[model samples]
Target: METTFKDFYDTLIENLECYAGEYESFIDYGPKLFKVLCDLLNSDVDKSLRLVISAAIGYYVTPVDVIPEQTYGPYGYIDDIYLSSHVLKMVADVHGYGFIAKISSPDIEEIIIECEVKSLEILSDEEIESILAYIGL
Candidate 1:
């Protein structure tokens, strides 16, 4: 069965402290994702696409969420992960993943890991589908 969002936070947080290797990758993911977003913004993409991308970025940094970051700590990033993957995939579909091509291997590893995780761990597929529909996707 697919991982429901219900288990996402616990699973994510559980994995965080279990591994022994350097987790600098997690710390680096934010900046790398932001840089990709910046590239998207600077590109000659369509206005609607740009707006959705902006909303995704805004959603990442915004404290407000289904579970507020203030209350959840690291697990709070769940929404950001999901939205970011969606935007990145869309951006890749249009502009190519070359936005991330020049990034360091470790950072690329983090990006690929995050994209894989978020792509699978959608919080509420129906809900996000509705939002995207409303946004004209």
Candidate 2:
């Protein structure tokens, strides 16, 4: 009952897409997710898991791949997928069976979906506009 990397990737992508219109929100959440990942990596009761998480995070956060976000449309999603895959792998490695169990639980999905929806709800139209302007969109 191990959690596959694909499960975690799907969850992260789903949450991220919910905030698509809010650049500031994405900027905020992305780094927080990275920090959570870094902490998880550093807290390796199993050293092997820790190493994988560390390496994956390093690869995920580094912005030196493919086209930049300025390229627009699908180009931006390339980096998103890369980062998502790394995070997913780390989650799967660390949590293993527990992660899979949680993924299968409707409550877990509901909580994530609800949280994502609430986060989006709190964002104001003006705030979104400001973020777009800041990003030169």
Candidate 3:
């Protein structure tokens, strides 16, 4: 991965640890994630960034999920953190962090920050890879 990707990953991971099980976190963050996705997808960013942002949003809504949200209970959001991290890397790589501020969702940006702070922090590379493969992203 590129340096920017690494930095985003590290930052997100640290933040995720802090937000893992807050109240309403799942419902709050999920829509916020998709809202940001909508903002990015509709932005003037390059086609590649649009595709990545779309994939991340798609991953969020897919019913046949990788980790099966019901099975993991609240912890299911770990995958959410990963997807958010993926979007952040793509956004930072193509447009830095400024575009994140352009999202129109009422609380999506704050929700994303909360998601990062509280998302599952112990996911393994192999586990995440399994999810990506399961989702075919």
lDDT of each: 0.56, 0.43, 0.59
TM-scores, each model vs. reference: 0.58, 0.38, 0.63
Better of 1 and 3 by TM-score: 3
lDDT of 3 by residue, 2-50 (tens): 5544433243344344554544445345544655666676678777677
lDDT agreement of model 1 with the native = 0.56
Ranking of all candidate structures by their TM-score, best first:
3, 1, 2
RMSD per candidate (Å) reads: 10.9, 14.7, 12.1
Best by lDDT: 3
Cα lDDT over the full model 3: 0.59
Q: Flag clash pairs in model 1.
A: none
lDDT (0-100) at residue 70 of candidate 2?
40
Clashing pairs in 2: none
- Please write out the lDDT profile of model 1 over residues 8-125, one tens digit for every residue: 3234345445434333334335445555665667767656678888886666556666545578665555555556666777766765566545442334545756754753454577
Candidate 3 RMSD to the correct structure: 12.1
Deviating ranges (above 4 Å) for candidate 1: 1-28, 99-113, 122-137
